[model samples]
Target: MNRREFLKKTAVSAAATSLLAWPNEVWAGGTVNLTILHTNDMHSRIDPFPNDGRTNGGLGGMARRATLINQIRQQEKNVLLLDSGDIFQGTPYFNFFGGELEYKLMTQMRYDATTFGNHDFDNGLAGLQRQLPNAGFSFLSANYDFSNTILKNQFQPYQVFEKEGIKIGVFGLGIELAGLVDKKNYGATVYLDPGQRAADMVKQLREKENCNLVICLSHLGYKYENAKIDDRKLAQQVPGIDLILGGHTHTFMEAPEKINRTNGHETLINQVGWAGINLGRMDFTFSKKSKQKINVAAAVLPIGKTVISS
Candidate 1:
């Protein structure tokens, strides 16, 4: 079969084999379930849109998102909340406080990890560096090299989380910053090839770190017509990446896309709309019997008035 045909067949088979068929040994070894909640391109939207007749009016406030997240945490034993960057810029909040309030509020919301988007450098490296202390979570990025910059020691390439005996490895990937960002803003931050870097990170995570699952937080857009590397291409280029949470283009996907990769492996890619308009969720069930066996369920939650008061 050609590459395209093989990819299609592999995608279908992988999804069905993992989701439908379960080995008998799986039941004996017990199962671990993890719920991953994520947001992308939040753009410093701290408050809901004005109640005016705009499309997203009265939706997407930090308080409302916090309330929904709290409710989910209360129900799920093992949960991870992550962001896909562009955390800065958009509203008056960022304009006045220079991303300080954005990080503080995300800290309050208990974000586990976040990546940096192009707009994140809008206030310059010094601007973002100043607000790093306000964040309770880690900033992860494998592709952006900050060795000679103020952010050199600030962000991590990858993070490992062990929840209920399941080891999850998550790393970050950013877009090419040269043309997208101002030279003054992203000074000395080298942008590596995401597909190449992701391959290396996943290899380490799976082989050396012994992580049961691997996730990629990517600022690469969903897809492009000109063959620029995006999440879909990244998935195919790298192996062992279980899921990719993406941002940058603000493509709203109703469900996660199952992308077939080399060697029969598949990657699930999901992205929510921008401006904190929606929350993306993916649930994974892993069985001890077959380490590669997984069942995934995905959903998108529209941001609106929550049970918690504003």
Candidate 2:
């Protein structure tokens, strides 16, 4: 469909409300709302800041984020929590416990999936390997070959989640680890082209896995002036990706950026910045009759001191 047609369809489908209860029947076939909650590059800030007059002081602790996520889970019938990358490094917590604490806490938060970041190798291959089992969630990295390394059997390429009858496929695409990451830390792990990996994995998820929605958890940042393959570039080059939750640039976006794919399909790219400064929420509604996704509404929730009310 063209952009104008899609917009008209969005509006038309949105008006398919039930008179009896409204809001519940927003699609021709009853609609199922899937709430996607995401974050990126949370670098081990276990505790909130010390209220040093900085706006973000005492804002991004795991406690606050957990409470917020729990509240959303309670309210939303179908919710998927995901993180892009850079789950390790930054604070003294990483310096002290390696990546154990971060993974453990993410397990507590019930993160469905995540991707790898360069900083995850801060403690070297041994460090990430040591804390792998502590993570309750699976890491979905389509690229980053761990065939002959300690991380060989630790990660998966993608994950499929059945939420409220919507088959959601979540995949990960890591940036090139060679030039940016130290060889000593990365060991013999091979890095493939993210563009190719995205095309391949997204195709599999869309065609083979039969996922209704495909999301790419990318650590390639946003746009770059230096001709880097960021999320914007990925959206244009790769096909069949419905959404891209990005990281590595630490960009705090208020809403999703809509990009047109090669097939002229809309692709949404969103990022919540680093340090858990915001929570990116995208609500997708799927049709019960046709079982097709009909509409999407997106907004970013900023994480201020009061988000937790602690």
> Clashes per prediction?
0, 0
For 79-166, candidate 1 gives per-residue lDDT tens digits of: 9999999999999999999999999889998999999999999999999888888999999999999999988878789999998778
Clashing pairs in 2: none
TM-scores of the models, in the order given: 0.91, 0.89
- For model 1, the stretches where C-alpha displacement exceeds 4 angstroms are 1-18, 288-292, 305-310
Top model by lDDT, which number?
A: 1
TM-score of candidate 2 on Cα atoms, chains taken together: 0.89
Which 10 successive residues of model 1 have the least lDDT summed? 9-18
Candidate 2 local lDDT, 41-101, one digit each (tens) = 9988777767899867656778778887886777678889999999998888888888888
RMSD of each: 7.1, 6.6
